[model samples]
Target: MGLLIIRLITFLNSQAPETTNYHIAMTMLANYSNLHLISIGKIAKLCNVSKSTISKFARQLGFDDYLDLKDNAAFIENRFNNPLNYLSNILTSIETDGFDNYLNAVTTDINFLRVNLDFDAVDNIAKAINDYDNVAAFGLVFSESAAIDMQYKLAYNGKFIRTFQDDVIQEDFLRNAGEDTLIIILTNSGDYLTKQQIKLGTPRKDIFSKTKAKIVVISSNPVVKNFSFVDEALIFPHQTKYQTHSIMYQIITDLIVSRYRYFNSLL
Candidate 1:
Protein backbone atom coordinates (compact mmCIF):
# COMPACT_ATOMS: atom_id res chain seq x y z
CA MET A 1 0.00 0.00 0.00
CA GLY A 2 2.75 2.40 0.92
CA LEU A 3 4.77 1.63 -2.20
CA LEU A 4 1.74 2.06 -4.42
CA ILE A 5 0.71 5.26 -2.68
CA ILE A 6 4.18 6.73 -3.02
CA ARG A 7 4.43 5.60 -6.64
CA LEU A 8 1.00 6.96 -7.45
CA ILE A 9 1.86 10.28 -5.92
CA THR A 10 5.12 10.38 -7.82
CA PHE A 11 3.32 9.64 -11.05
CA LEU A 12 0.63 12.25 -10.39
CA ASN A 13 3.17 14.89 -9.43
CA SER A 14 5.37 14.17 -12.52
CA GLN A 15 7.98 16.33 -10.84
CA ALA A 16 9.98 13.23 -9.89
CA PRO A 17 13.08 11.93 -11.64
CA GLU A 18 13.55 9.03 -14.08
CA THR A 19 13.86 6.61 -11.20
CA THR A 20 11.49 7.95 -8.54
CA ASN A 21 12.40 8.27 -4.86
CA TYR A 22 10.27 5.25 -3.97
CA HIS A 23 13.15 2.79 -3.85
CA ILE A 24 15.44 5.26 -2.11
CA ALA A 25 12.91 6.05 0.64
CA MET A 26 11.85 2.43 0.97
CA THR A 27 15.44 1.28 1.54
CA MET A 28 15.95 3.71 4.41
CA LEU A 29 12.49 3.05 5.89
CA ALA A 30 13.16 -0.68 5.72
CA ASN A 31 15.95 -0.43 8.31
CA TYR A 32 15.11 2.52 10.55
CA SER A 33 12.30 1.44 12.83
CA ASN A 34 11.33 3.22 16.09
CA LEU A 35 13.56 1.20 18.41
CA HIS A 36 16.76 1.49 16.40
CA LEU A 37 15.83 4.93 15.21
CA ILE A 38 17.80 7.64 13.38
CA SER A 39 17.20 11.29 12.59
CA ILE A 40 15.08 12.39 9.58
CA GLY A 41 18.08 14.31 8.18
CA LYS A 42 20.15 11.14 8.57
CA ILE A 43 17.57 9.13 6.65
CA ALA A 44 17.37 11.79 3.94
CA LYS A 45 21.17 11.88 3.74
CA LEU A 46 21.32 8.09 3.50
CA CYS A 47 18.65 8.13 0.78
CA ASN A 48 20.75 10.85 -0.96
CA VAL A 49 17.77 13.20 -1.11
CA SER A 50 17.00 16.51 0.58
CA LYS A 51 15.35 16.78 4.02
CA SER A 52 12.56 18.96 2.55
CA THR A 53 11.81 16.28 -0.01
CA ILE A 54 11.64 13.67 2.71
CA SER A 55 9.24 15.84 4.70
CA LYS A 56 7.14 16.42 1.62
CA PHE A 57 7.16 12.70 0.92
CA ALA A 58 6.00 12.04 4.47
CA ARG A 59 3.29 14.70 4.25
CA GLN A 60 2.12 13.29 0.93
CA LEU A 61 1.71 9.94 2.65
CA GLY A 62 -0.53 11.66 5.30
CA PHE A 63 2.08 11.72 8.04
CA ASP A 64 2.21 14.98 10.03
CA ASP A 65 6.01 15.02 9.97
CA TYR A 66 9.10 12.88 9.60
CA LEU A 67 8.65 11.57 13.17
CA ASP A 68 5.20 10.28 12.27
CA LEU A 69 6.70 8.58 9.22
CA LYS A 70 9.26 6.90 11.39
CA ASP A 71 6.59 5.68 13.83
CA ASN A 72 4.34 4.40 11.06
CA ALA A 73 7.27 2.89 9.15
CA ALA A 74 8.37 1.19 12.34
CA PHE A 75 4.98 -0.47 12.57
CA ILE A 76 5.08 -1.42 8.91
CA GLU A 77 8.62 -2.71 9.21
CA ASN A 78 7.79 -4.82 12.25
CA ARG A 79 4.61 -6.12 10.62
CA PHE A 80 6.47 -7.35 7.54
CA ASN A 81 9.61 -8.45 9.38
CA ASN A 82 10.59 -12.07 10.03
CA PRO A 83 7.88 -14.06 11.81
CA LEU A 84 10.13 -15.66 14.37
CA ASN A 85 8.09 -14.38 17.30
CA TYR A 86 9.28 -17.29 19.43
CA LEU A 87 12.97 -16.70 18.69
CA SER A 88 13.81 -15.21 22.08
CA ASN A 89 12.19 -18.17 23.80
CA ILE A 90 13.86 -20.56 21.38
CA LEU A 91 17.20 -19.06 22.29
CA THR A 92 16.41 -19.26 25.99
CA SER A 93 15.58 -22.91 25.48
CA ILE A 94 18.91 -23.48 23.80
CA GLU A 95 20.84 -22.04 26.77
CA THR A 96 18.76 -23.85 29.35
CA ASP A 97 16.55 -27.01 29.17
CA GLY A 98 13.55 -25.38 27.49
CA PHE A 99 12.44 -28.18 25.18
CA ASP A 100 8.98 -26.76 24.44
CA ASN A 101 10.57 -23.57 23.21
CA TYR A 102 12.64 -25.60 20.79
CA LEU A 103 9.52 -27.45 19.74
CA ASN A 104 7.83 -24.12 19.13
CA ALA A 105 10.35 -23.30 16.38
CA VAL A 106 9.39 -26.43 14.46
CA THR A 107 5.71 -25.72 15.02
CA THR A 108 6.22 -22.13 13.91
CA ASP A 109 7.65 -23.36 10.61
CA ILE A 110 4.75 -25.79 10.33
CA ASN A 111 2.35 -22.93 10.94
CA PHE A 112 4.08 -20.98 8.17
CA LEU A 113 3.51 -23.93 5.82
CA ARG A 114 -0.08 -24.27 7.00
CA VAL A 115 -0.72 -20.67 6.04
CA ASN A 116 1.36 -20.50 2.83
CA LEU A 117 0.82 -23.82 1.02
CA ASP A 118 -2.07 -23.67 -1.42
CA PHE A 119 -3.57 -27.12 -2.01
CA ASP A 120 -5.07 -25.86 -5.25
CA ALA A 121 -1.56 -25.08 -6.52
CA VAL A 122 -0.47 -28.57 -5.52
CA ASP A 123 -3.48 -30.05 -7.31
CA ASN A 124 -2.71 -28.00 -10.42
CA ILE A 125 0.89 -29.23 -10.50
CA ALA A 126 -0.33 -32.79 -9.98
CA LYS A 127 -2.80 -32.50 -12.83
CA ALA A 128 -0.06 -31.18 -15.09
CA ILE A 129 2.17 -34.12 -14.13
CA ASN A 130 -0.62 -36.53 -15.04
CA ASP A 131 -1.43 -34.76 -18.28
CA TYR A 132 2.06 -34.07 -19.57
CA ASP A 133 3.74 -36.56 -21.95
CA ASN A 134 7.12 -36.03 -20.29
CA VAL A 135 7.68 -35.19 -16.63
CA ALA A 136 11.23 -34.00 -15.88
CA ALA A 137 12.26 -33.47 -12.25
CA PHE A 138 15.27 -31.26 -11.44
CA GLY A 139 17.12 -30.64 -8.19
CA LEU A 140 20.75 -30.15 -7.20
CA VAL A 141 22.92 -31.97 -4.63
CA PHE A 142 20.67 -31.69 -1.56
CA SER A 143 17.53 -32.18 -3.65
CA GLU A 144 18.98 -34.56 -6.29
CA SER A 145 18.15 -37.47 -4.02
CA ALA A 146 14.55 -36.29 -3.71
CA ALA A 147 14.25 -35.89 -7.47
CA ILE A 148 15.71 -39.34 -8.14
CA ASP A 149 13.57 -40.84 -5.40
CA MET A 150 10.48 -39.26 -6.89
CA GLN A 151 11.42 -40.49 -10.35
CA TYR A 152 11.73 -44.08 -9.14
CA LYS A 153 8.57 -43.88 -7.04
CA LEU A 154 6.46 -42.44 -9.87
CA ALA A 155 7.86 -44.97 -12.34
CA TYR A 156 6.97 -47.76 -9.88
CA ASN A 157 3.49 -46.34 -9.58
CA GLY A 158 3.23 -46.38 -13.42
CA LYS A 159 4.39 -42.88 -14.27
CA PHE A 160 7.35 -42.14 -16.50
CA ILE A 161 9.31 -39.57 -14.47
CA ARG A 162 12.67 -38.21 -15.68
CA THR A 163 15.41 -36.81 -13.47
CA PHE A 164 17.96 -34.27 -14.78
CA GLN A 165 20.91 -33.71 -12.45
CA ASP A 166 23.45 -32.39 -14.92
CA ASP A 167 23.18 -28.80 -16.20
CA VAL A 168 24.49 -29.71 -19.65
CA ILE A 169 21.92 -32.49 -19.91
CA GLN A 170 19.19 -30.10 -18.75
CA GLU A 171 20.20 -27.45 -21.30
CA ASP A 172 20.37 -30.05 -24.08
CA PHE A 173 16.97 -31.50 -23.14
CA LEU A 174 15.36 -28.09 -22.67
CA ARG A 175 16.62 -27.09 -26.06
CA ASN A 176 14.36 -29.79 -27.48
CA ALA A 177 11.78 -29.91 -24.65
CA GLY A 178 8.29 -28.65 -25.46
CA GLU A 179 4.86 -27.75 -24.05
CA ASP A 180 4.15 -31.41 -23.44
CA THR A 181 6.87 -31.42 -20.80
CA LEU A 182 6.11 -30.70 -17.15
CA ILE A 183 9.32 -29.59 -15.41
CA ILE A 184 9.18 -29.77 -11.62
CA ILE A 185 12.16 -28.13 -9.91
CA LEU A 186 13.07 -28.64 -6.28
CA THR A 187 15.44 -26.07 -4.77
CA ASN A 188 16.07 -24.77 -1.28
CA SER A 189 16.49 -21.40 -2.98
CA GLY A 190 14.36 -20.72 -6.05
CA ASP A 191 17.34 -19.21 -7.97
CA TYR A 192 18.25 -21.58 -10.81
CA LEU A 193 21.74 -22.21 -12.16
CA THR A 194 20.32 -21.25 -15.55
CA LYS A 195 19.67 -17.74 -14.26
CA GLN A 196 23.20 -17.38 -12.93
CA GLN A 197 26.52 -16.32 -14.42
CA ILE A 198 27.64 -17.04 -17.97
CA LYS A 199 29.51 -15.15 -20.73
CA LEU A 200 26.84 -14.92 -23.41
CA GLY A 201 23.14 -14.04 -23.46
CA THR A 202 21.98 -17.27 -25.17
CA PRO A 203 23.87 -19.47 -22.71
CA ARG A 204 22.34 -17.78 -19.65
CA LYS A 205 18.66 -17.42 -20.64
CA ASP A 206 18.43 -19.99 -23.43
CA ILE A 207 17.51 -22.90 -21.16
CA PHE A 208 14.24 -21.29 -20.19
CA SER A 209 13.60 -19.44 -23.46
CA LYS A 210 13.99 -22.64 -25.49
CA THR A 211 11.52 -24.67 -23.43
CA LYS A 212 7.75 -24.40 -23.57
CA ALA A 213 7.50 -26.70 -20.54
CA LYS A 214 5.11 -25.92 -17.72
CA ILE A 215 7.16 -25.31 -14.59
CA VAL A 216 6.60 -26.33 -10.98
CA VAL A 217 9.03 -24.71 -8.52
CA ILE A 218 9.21 -25.72 -4.86
CA SER A 219 11.52 -23.51 -2.84
CA SER A 220 12.21 -22.15 0.69
CA ASN A 221 14.07 -18.96 -0.26
CA PRO A 222 12.25 -15.88 1.00
CA VAL A 223 14.19 -13.63 -1.35
CA VAL A 224 12.75 -15.37 -4.43
CA LYS A 225 10.07 -12.91 -5.50
CA ASN A 226 8.58 -14.19 -8.71
CA PHE A 227 8.52 -17.34 -10.79
CA SER A 228 7.10 -15.71 -13.91
CA PHE A 229 7.68 -18.84 -16.03
CA VAL A 230 6.32 -21.19 -13.40
CA ASP A 231 2.84 -22.64 -13.74
CA GLU A 232 2.65 -23.73 -10.12
CA ALA A 233 4.91 -22.95 -7.17
CA LEU A 234 4.77 -24.71 -3.80
CA ILE A 235 6.73 -22.44 -1.47
CA PHE A 236 7.70 -23.74 1.96
CA PRO A 237 9.06 -21.85 5.00
CA HIS A 238 11.85 -19.32 4.63
CA GLN A 239 15.35 -20.61 5.36
CA THR A 240 16.50 -20.69 8.97
CA LYS A 241 19.93 -21.61 10.32
CA TYR A 242 18.70 -23.47 13.41
CA GLN A 243 16.70 -26.20 11.68
CA THR A 244 17.60 -28.66 8.91
CA HIS A 245 15.53 -27.05 6.09
CA SER A 246 16.17 -30.04 3.83
CA ILE A 247 13.56 -31.84 5.93
CA MET A 248 11.11 -29.12 4.97
CA TYR A 249 12.03 -29.57 1.32
CA GLN A 250 11.68 -33.33 1.65
CA ILE A 251 8.28 -32.97 3.29
CA ILE A 252 7.10 -30.74 0.44
CA THR A 253 8.42 -33.30 -2.04
CA ASP A 254 6.51 -36.03 -0.23
CA LEU A 255 3.30 -34.04 -0.30
CA ILE A 256 3.61 -33.27 -4.01
CA VAL A 257 4.37 -36.91 -4.86
CA SER A 258 1.55 -38.14 -2.65
CA ARG A 259 -0.87 -35.73 -4.27
CA TYR A 260 0.38 -36.72 -7.71
CA ARG A 261 -0.03 -40.39 -6.84
CA TYR A 262 -3.58 -39.93 -5.62
CA PHE A 263 -4.56 -38.03 -8.74
CA ASN A 264 -2.81 -40.59 -10.89
CA SER A 265 -4.69 -43.36 -9.12
CA LEU A 266 -7.97 -41.64 -9.90
CA LEU A 267 -7.06 -41.61 -13.58
Candidate 2:
Protein backbone atom coordinates (compact mmCIF):
# COMPACT_ATOMS: atom_id res chain seq x y z
CA MET A 1 0.00 0.00 0.00
CA GLY A 2 1.22 3.53 -0.72
CA LEU A 3 1.63 6.08 2.04
CA LEU A 4 -1.24 8.16 0.69
CA ILE A 5 -3.54 5.20 1.01
CA ILE A 6 -2.27 4.50 4.48
CA ARG A 7 -2.85 8.11 5.54
CA LEU A 8 -6.31 8.12 4.10
CA ILE A 9 -7.11 4.88 5.84
CA THR A 10 -5.79 6.29 9.08
CA PHE A 11 -7.89 9.42 8.73
CA LEU A 12 -10.96 7.37 7.95
CA ASN A 13 -10.39 5.33 11.07
CA SER A 14 -10.27 8.42 13.21
CA GLN A 15 -13.33 9.39 15.22
CA ALA A 16 -15.93 11.48 13.48
CA PRO A 17 -15.10 15.15 13.43
CA GLU A 18 -16.48 17.18 16.34
CA THR A 19 -16.15 20.57 14.71
CA THR A 20 -16.80 22.02 11.27
CA ASN A 21 -13.15 22.93 10.94
CA TYR A 22 -12.13 19.38 11.74
CA HIS A 23 -14.64 18.08 9.23
CA ILE A 24 -13.26 20.35 6.55
CA ALA A 25 -9.72 19.17 7.29
CA MET A 26 -10.74 15.51 7.15
CA THR A 27 -12.47 16.05 3.86
CA MET A 28 -9.45 17.82 2.39
CA LEU A 29 -7.10 15.02 3.33
CA ALA A 30 -9.55 12.37 2.20
CA ASN A 31 -10.17 13.96 -1.16
CA TYR A 32 -6.49 14.76 -1.57
CA SER A 33 -5.57 11.14 -0.94
CA ASN A 34 -7.96 9.94 -3.58
CA LEU A 35 -7.10 12.74 -6.00
CA HIS A 36 -3.40 12.47 -5.07
CA LEU A 37 -3.10 16.21 -4.39
CA ILE A 38 -4.86 19.55 -3.77
CA SER A 39 -4.15 23.13 -2.80
CA ILE A 40 -5.50 25.13 0.16
CA GLY A 41 -7.63 27.29 -2.11
CA LYS A 42 -8.89 24.25 -3.95
CA ILE A 43 -9.66 22.50 -0.71
CA ALA A 44 -11.47 25.56 0.54
CA LYS A 45 -13.33 25.86 -2.74
CA LEU A 46 -14.34 22.24 -2.63
CA CYS A 47 -15.44 22.49 0.97
CA ASN A 48 -17.32 25.72 0.28
CA VAL A 49 -15.38 27.41 3.01
CA SER A 50 -12.80 30.17 3.29
CA LYS A 51 -9.08 29.48 2.88
CA SER A 52 -8.68 30.22 6.57
CA THR A 53 -11.14 27.45 7.27
CA ILE A 54 -8.95 24.98 5.44
CA SER A 55 -5.92 26.25 7.29
CA LYS A 56 -7.67 25.76 10.61
CA PHE A 57 -8.64 22.32 9.44
CA ALA A 58 -5.01 21.47 8.93
CA ARG A 59 -4.05 22.63 12.39
CA GLN A 60 -6.85 20.58 13.83
CA LEU A 61 -5.39 17.55 12.08
CA GLY A 62 -2.20 18.09 14.08
CA PHE A 63 -0.29 19.84 11.34
CA ASP A 64 1.57 23.02 12.16
CA ASP A 65 0.04 24.68 9.11
CA TYR A 66 -1.49 23.94 5.75
CA LEU A 67 1.84 23.76 3.97
CA ASP A 68 3.15 21.37 6.60
CA LEU A 69 0.28 18.99 6.02
CA LYS A 70 0.70 19.12 2.27
CA ASP A 71 4.44 18.52 2.44
CA ASN A 72 4.04 15.64 4.85
CA ALA A 73 1.41 14.08 2.69
CA ALA A 74 3.63 14.37 -0.38
CA PHE A 75 6.58 12.81 1.45
CA ILE A 76 4.54 9.87 2.66
CA GLU A 77 2.92 9.34 -0.74
CA ASN A 78 6.33 9.24 -2.44
CA ARG A 79 7.34 6.15 -0.42
CA PHE A 80 4.62 3.90 -1.78
CA ASN A 81 4.31 1.58 -4.80
CA ASN A 82 1.84 3.71 -6.73
CA PRO A 83 3.90 5.90 -9.03
CA LEU A 84 0.78 7.39 -10.54
CA ASN A 85 -0.44 8.57 -7.17
CA TYR A 86 2.93 10.01 -6.23
CA LEU A 87 3.18 11.88 -9.49
CA SER A 88 -0.29 13.29 -9.01
CA ASN A 89 0.72 14.67 -5.64
CA ILE A 90 3.82 16.29 -7.12
CA LEU A 91 1.81 17.88 -9.89
CA THR A 92 -0.72 19.17 -7.42
CA SER A 93 2.03 20.62 -5.33
CA ILE A 94 3.42 22.29 -8.40
CA GLU A 95 0.09 23.89 -9.19
CA THR A 96 -0.09 25.39 -5.71
CA ASP A 97 2.98 27.62 -6.19
CA GLY A 98 4.79 29.44 -8.97
CA PHE A 99 7.49 28.33 -11.41
CA ASP A 100 9.84 27.56 -8.51
CA ASN A 101 7.55 24.79 -7.26
CA TYR A 102 7.32 23.26 -10.70
CA LEU A 103 11.07 23.30 -11.10
CA ASN A 104 11.49 21.74 -7.67
CA ALA A 105 9.10 18.91 -8.46
CA VAL A 106 10.90 18.11 -11.71
CA THR A 107 14.23 18.23 -9.95
CA THR A 108 12.89 15.94 -7.24
CA ASP A 109 11.71 13.44 -9.80
CA ILE A 110 15.04 13.50 -11.64
CA ASN A 111 16.89 13.00 -8.38
CA PHE A 112 14.65 10.08 -7.55
CA LEU A 113 15.38 8.51 -10.93
CA ARG A 114 19.10 8.92 -10.41
CA VAL A 115 19.06 7.44 -6.94
CA ASN A 116 16.91 4.35 -7.66
CA LEU A 117 18.02 3.38 -11.15
CA ASP A 118 20.14 0.23 -11.35
CA PHE A 119 22.68 0.62 -14.15
CA ASP A 120 23.83 -2.99 -13.89
CA ALA A 121 20.26 -4.15 -14.27
CA VAL A 122 19.81 -1.88 -17.27
CA ASP A 123 23.00 -3.24 -18.82
CA ASN A 124 21.73 -6.78 -18.37
CA ILE A 125 18.47 -5.89 -20.06
CA ALA A 126 20.32 -4.26 -22.96
CA LYS A 127 22.55 -7.26 -23.39
CA ALA A 128 19.57 -9.62 -23.33
CA ILE A 129 17.81 -7.59 -25.99
CA ASN A 130 20.90 -7.43 -28.16
CA ASP A 131 21.42 -11.17 -27.94
CA TYR A 132 17.76 -12.20 -28.22
CA ASP A 133 16.42 -13.45 -31.50
CA ASN A 134 12.93 -12.33 -30.49
CA VAL A 135 11.44 -9.94 -27.94
CA ALA A 136 7.91 -9.65 -26.57
CA ALA A 137 6.43 -7.00 -24.30
CA PHE A 138 3.37 -7.39 -22.09
CA GLY A 139 1.36 -5.08 -19.84
CA LEU A 140 -1.94 -5.11 -18.01
CA VAL A 141 -4.86 -2.80 -18.85
CA PHE A 142 -3.23 0.46 -17.71
CA SER A 143 0.14 -0.57 -19.05
CA GLU A 144 -0.86 -2.02 -22.41
CA SER A 145 -0.45 1.28 -24.22
CA ALA A 146 2.97 1.80 -22.73
CA ALA A 147 4.00 -1.69 -23.81
CA ILE A 148 2.90 -0.93 -27.35
CA ASP A 149 4.74 2.37 -27.27
CA MET A 150 7.92 0.62 -26.27
CA GLN A 151 7.43 -1.93 -29.00
CA TYR A 152 7.10 0.78 -31.62
CA LYS A 153 10.18 2.60 -30.38
CA LEU A 154 12.29 -0.55 -30.27
CA ALA A 155 11.07 -1.65 -33.68
CA TYR A 156 12.24 1.59 -35.27
CA ASN A 157 15.79 0.49 -34.54
CA GLY A 158 15.33 -2.67 -36.63
CA LYS A 159 14.49 -4.96 -33.70
CA PHE A 160 11.65 -7.43 -33.73
CA ILE A 161 9.47 -6.27 -30.83
CA ARG A 162 6.10 -7.89 -30.32
CA THR A 163 3.50 -6.51 -27.93
CA PHE A 164 1.13 -9.00 -26.29
CA GLN A 165 -2.16 -8.34 -24.51
CA ASP A 166 -3.59 -11.80 -24.04
CA ASP A 167 -2.28 -14.97 -22.43
CA VAL A 168 -2.68 -17.18 -25.48
CA ILE A 169 -0.33 -14.98 -27.47
CA GLN A 170 1.96 -14.49 -24.48
CA GLU A 171 2.30 -18.18 -23.78
CA ASP A 172 2.90 -18.88 -27.42
CA PHE A 173 5.66 -16.36 -27.34
CA LEU A 174 7.00 -17.65 -24.04
CA ARG A 175 7.06 -21.25 -25.21
CA ASN A 176 8.90 -20.18 -28.31
CA ALA A 177 11.17 -17.78 -26.42
CA GLY A 178 14.53 -19.37 -25.73
CA GLU A 179 17.54 -18.42 -23.61
CA ASP A 180 18.27 -15.76 -26.18
CA THR A 181 14.79 -14.25 -25.92
CA LEU A 182 13.69 -11.32 -23.77
CA ILE A 183 10.31 -10.63 -22.17
CA ILE A 184 9.61 -7.10 -20.97
CA ILE A 185 6.63 -6.56 -18.69
CA LEU A 186 5.10 -3.25 -17.57
CA THR A 187 2.80 -3.02 -14.57
CA ASN A 188 2.30 -0.32 -11.97
CA SER A 189 -0.20 -2.25 -9.91
CA GLY A 190 2.17 -5.21 -9.86
CA ASP A 191 -0.54 -7.60 -10.94
CA TYR A 192 -0.49 -9.24 -14.40
CA LEU A 193 -2.30 -12.14 -16.01
CA THR A 194 -1.50 -15.58 -14.64
CA LYS A 195 -4.12 -18.08 -15.77
CA GLN A 196 -4.55 -20.60 -18.57
CA GLN A 197 -2.40 -20.01 -21.63
CA ILE A 198 -5.44 -19.75 -23.87
CA LYS A 199 -7.07 -17.08 -21.74
CA LEU A 200 -4.80 -14.17 -22.65
CA GLY A 201 -3.83 -13.85 -18.99
CA THR A 202 -0.93 -15.20 -17.00
CA PRO A 203 -0.20 -14.43 -13.44
CA ARG A 204 2.81 -12.12 -13.36
CA LYS A 205 4.26 -14.32 -10.64
CA ASP A 206 3.92 -17.42 -12.73
CA ILE A 207 5.45 -15.75 -15.75
CA PHE A 208 8.48 -14.83 -13.70
CA SER A 209 8.79 -18.27 -12.17
CA LYS A 210 8.16 -20.35 -15.27
CA THR A 211 9.67 -18.47 -18.17
CA LYS A 212 13.12 -19.52 -19.36
CA ALA A 213 13.75 -16.32 -21.24
CA LYS A 214 15.28 -13.22 -19.64
CA ILE A 215 12.57 -11.06 -18.03
CA VAL A 216 12.59 -7.34 -17.31
CA VAL A 217 9.86 -5.71 -15.23
CA ILE A 218 9.06 -1.99 -15.12
CA SER A 219 6.98 -1.84 -12.00
CA SER A 220 5.87 0.55 -9.25
CA ASN A 221 5.91 -2.12 -6.58
CA PRO A 222 9.17 -3.36 -5.10
CA VAL A 223 7.89 -6.95 -5.01
CA VAL A 224 8.94 -7.35 -8.62
CA LYS A 225 12.55 -7.43 -7.45
CA ASN A 226 11.81 -10.30 -5.09
CA PHE A 227 11.11 -12.73 -7.92
CA SER A 228 14.15 -14.90 -8.48
CA PHE A 229 13.06 -15.61 -12.03
CA VAL A 230 13.23 -11.94 -12.96
CA ASP A 231 16.54 -11.00 -14.58
CA GLU A 232 16.11 -7.26 -14.03
CA ALA A 233 13.65 -4.84 -12.43
CA LEU A 234 13.23 -1.09 -12.95
CA ILE A 235 11.12 0.86 -10.48
CA PHE A 236 9.63 4.16 -11.58
CA PRO A 237 8.96 7.04 -9.21
CA HIS A 238 5.73 6.64 -7.29
CA GLN A 239 2.85 8.90 -8.34
CA THR A 240 0.12 10.43 -6.20
CA LYS A 241 -3.59 9.70 -6.58
CA TYR A 242 -4.44 12.44 -9.07
CA GLN A 243 -1.63 11.69 -11.55
CA THR A 244 -1.53 9.20 -14.42
CA HIS A 245 1.20 6.70 -15.30
CA SER A 246 1.77 8.00 -18.83
CA ILE A 247 4.62 10.35 -17.93
CA MET A 248 6.51 7.75 -15.95
CA TYR A 249 6.06 5.22 -18.73
CA GLN A 250 7.42 7.73 -21.24
CA ILE A 251 10.44 8.43 -19.06
CA ILE A 252 11.23 4.74 -18.56
CA THR A 253 10.85 3.89 -22.24
CA ASP A 254 13.01 6.84 -23.25
CA LEU A 255 15.73 5.76 -20.84
CA ILE A 256 15.68 2.23 -22.23
CA VAL A 257 15.84 3.47 -25.81
CA SER A 258 18.70 5.83 -24.96
CA ARG A 259 20.61 2.99 -23.36
CA TYR A 260 19.99 0.77 -26.31
CA ARG A 261 21.36 3.45 -28.63
CA TYR A 262 24.44 3.99 -26.50
CA PHE A 263 25.12 0.27 -26.32
CA ASN A 264 24.66 -0.12 -30.06
CA SER A 265 27.02 2.77 -30.70
CA LEU A 266 29.73 0.99 -28.73
CA LEU A 267 29.21 -2.16 -30.79
Among all candidates shown, the one with the greatest TM-score? 1
Backbone N/Cα/C clashes per model: 0, 20
Among all windows of ten consecutive residues in candidate 2, which has the lowest summed lDDT?
195-204
Cα displacement (angstroms), candidate 2, residue 162, comes to 1.2
Q: Each model's TM-score, in the order given?
A: 0.54, 0.53
* Model 2 alpha-carbon drift over 4 Å, by segment: 1-111, 193-207, 242-244
Query: Quick one: how many clashes does candidate 1 have?
Result: 0
Each prediction's RMSD over C-alphas, in Å, is 16.1, 15.8
Task: Tell me which residue pairs clash in candidate 1.
Answer: none
What tens-digit string does per-residue lDDT give for candidate 2 at 1-267? 222333344444554767565466467555765443677787778878899977775565445777766665643433434444434455555676655865655656656776877777667677667767778888754476788888888888777688765433555677667787788988765665333221212223355566688888887777878777777888765533333355677777877876876777777
Task: Give Cα-based local distance difference scores for all models.
Answer: 0.62, 0.64
- At residue 30, what lDDT does model 1 achieve? 59
